[model samples]
Target: MVTGVEMRQIDRYTIEEIGLTEELLMENAGQAFVNHIISLLDKKKARIAVLIGVGNNGGDGFVISRSLLEKGYHVDVWLVPPVSKVKGTARYHMDIYLKLGYQVNSFETISATGLSQIFMSYTHIIDALLGTGYNGPLRSPYREIIEEVNRSHGNILSVDIPSGLSADGNVDEPILAVKATHTITFQCPKLSSFLFPFREYLGELTIVDIGIPKRAIDQISSERFIWTEEDIIQTLPVRKPSSHKGSHGKGLIIAGSQAMTGAPILTAKACHRLGAGLVTLATPETAHQAIASQLIEATFHLCPSENGEIATLNLSNEVLDNRYDAIAVGPGLGRSTKGDFIDTLLTSFNKPLIIDADGLYYLKNFLPSLQMRKGVTVLTPHVGEFAYLMNEPIEKIEKNRFQFSKQFAEKYGVYLVLKGPYTIVTTPRGKQFINTTGNASLAKGGSGDVLTGMVLALIMQQRDVQSAISNAVFLHGKAADYLTRNGWSPISVIASDLVTIMPHVLEQYQYS
Candidate 1:
């Protein structure tokens, strides 16, 4: 989970509101840094070489030197520029170190060759050369030093962020970023830590609490979110002991055509396995036998269509009156034939709707009308489908997925699930949930059908749209996680295999 920080605002508070007194914050930050280092290393064997710059980050290195010295560990401080150039809290800490009889190496005293030789002796390197305040490309002594640090075999622990990468935007150039084994960041994790390119530079991240007041955090409002297990667990629906098949609620799956019966079968089977008391698969009459044979537990509702194609469907008033907790449409339902079928279903169905695949095609054509539905609607779309629905290119959607999802949800007043590596769920109320589960194993065919089924089942079980989406996404990713651990390829695990694994995954999360 990442907690993003606004660097400019934080710097402003530290400099202005905090009264420029480095003694308090620097002391806390340095002590926290020492605590982490102590936890990683043994006192008898720990030997650390600290790299210091002219800024506050360098001051942190100076303070860390004092802390390690007091603990009886061999510590060496290398100040990059001349000690006279160091100012502010950094110079203050350097003077204190010198007064306390600790040796501080100056850039002028040591030649490049001498510095290289000194760097070879340390087991671990502490990177305080540049902090989050650095912008643009590197220059001069710092650039040269970073190159040497990268070449060194010692493990580097970057302070806050890895030095050369931008804290906010895209960094273009072959800048040398610290290859830290662990980064001890203060307060919240930076946005760049989660974004790509820069994310590669940030190894394993550990956000350390530096006692920033909660009131200060509250003042900084951000729309981004990272979902955890605890965040979704409480939202799952609790089943009653007396719950019967009908009590769990019914889900209507209107999917598949003549040659595409497998899509609805996969969806209906998953819905049944996910604890939907009753699942009814509504497809063309010609495909009824195939769906029924595969989904033995689910009831079949045969709708009239043209020549085994889903060109049109006659859903009468009586069928609409029958209570269904949720309805899922589209999944291998052919685009050419099922376009009208989709339009009719959207206009007539007043239940919770799960729209995916071919249904998205029809919805895209008549989005304004579909958006006016009174019932709660969930649109599940991969990048291509999402782009088509929004009348934009795929690249635009991928670049600004979070913003696009949020805007789409707000525009339609419905829940939008932008499916991909990081599946984003956005609600009409402006809340966003970024899913962290699932892997490359889930990037196979029919996975979306299985997800639609699971989400529909959860919604039918009386869970809120948000809860249903979160639980469905988590469970889907968890299933992939299981396959990954068991050494099963995603291509080998069919949609039915996902249904069989659902019980075990749910049991792992079940409380006594």
Candidate 2:
């Protein structure tokens, strides 16, 4: 998704380079909106109110009002901020409204009591009062109009975006904005549609073709990337019938503590579930019984322990001799981890090293030398853990998720999966993927462990590291989404539930 600033650049390039006139584009946009809205409503009986502002957004409203009136929809036009202020292309459309015998009212003409009644009279409200350039709480009439639109029983359709939403919609904080039931955006989705708080306002987003050249959009390199299921289908590892256990990767997951043994077991099980040829859990000797009986298909390497925590010093030469394809560490691991052990793992395990959870905590002190490590490292950290790694405040990291994730991944020379609502999977080669799947359901305790295992399995199976990571993250969220759709509440869907639902998600995604 393009930010408001980047979208403006693409629009400028389209209009200037491609020679598409602004008036013509607005006309096309208005026509496209009218067509979509007609499909959503019965034209003959539909009573529509077009709330227009003084800018190009208002121009689109004027064109919409004219088109709807011509299509036999009962259309009322509200030329907000005074109709006299509407000028240029906007005024041109309003002039046609007057010439064609349609009425247009303004804030100056309509009384507050009458305004409420007029708004309530319409079955649908079209918000054209603001555009992508708008920021924060709207001033005066715009805010008042939006609040009334919200109060009304009308199904609101916003033009371009819900007016008053900050162009930087991806910010964590919530803002007062117009709540659009459906938004028919031109060209591409705006950044607000991708961000939090304000993202909730843009309900049922649809991108309408507005004649902008695709080549123009391809120029945006603001570290913004989107991954789809088709991307997963094309990139996921192909398992041949002739492939043996030796062909698929053997992943070693060193995790779990006495109290947190579930995390390691979850990771190990998820790895095996996702087609890992063999998954070995290297945990403290005491926690072996927990996973050994539950997940009997996997092998276990019991290490010396004290009070249920693994003695990193007791790691044997036999583990190094195993020559696993991928190794993941850190989930459910207590603070007993030593730097020498991490260094040994870094130096010994030359394949993909996925560090998550407590692994990030253990690796914090070794941050300076992370890039100098010998393997393909992947660090998966939630915002808090990520903030600690950067030695910055959590607020700062949360506010700049994409930038911070990208900088950290590039600086540390590791693929960073900054997990959150829209997970940021940043590759060392400067590519940032904004994952669009999953929901609040995946925000449980053992979710990260499940993700780590899924990533480890994909890395072992697929040689293309970035693609494997991206597909794993996507499928992880899709699993949560599957449970949410099939009778489970987001609150009830546990991390292990995601693991339970993975096969179903994968089968459905592959078939559907």
Q: Pick the candidate with the highest TM-score.
A: 2
Write candidate 1's Cα lDDT for 1-512 as tens digits.
Answer: 22323654654566576554556677777878888868887677767888888787888888888989988988888788787788988888888888999997766666678768777788888998888778777887888777777777787888888777666535654547776777887776666665455666777777777766544454553555667688666767778898788888788888888878788887987888778998888888888887777778888777776666565556674576486767898887876653765666667777888999988987877777677877788999999999998889987666567678888898888899989777888888768877878877777778899999999998877546787788898888888888767888766776667777888788767662
Which regions of candidate 2 fall more than 4 Å away from where they truly are?
92-101, 170-174, 313-322
Best of the candidates, lDDT: 2
281: Cα error in model 2, Å: 1.1
What are the models' TM-scores?
0.84, 0.93
Model 1, residue 254: what's the lDDT? 83
Each model's lDDT = 0.78, 0.82
Under the 3 Å rule for N, CA and C atoms, how many clashes does model 2 have? 3
Off by over 4 Å in 1: 1-23, 33-39, 42-47, 54-69, 72-75, 78-122, 141-152, 169-176, 305-309, 345-348, 391-396, 486-496
Tens digits of lDDT, candidate 2, 299-358 = 888877876788764555465647677889888888864635676776666778899998
* RMSD list, candidates in order: 3.8, 2.4
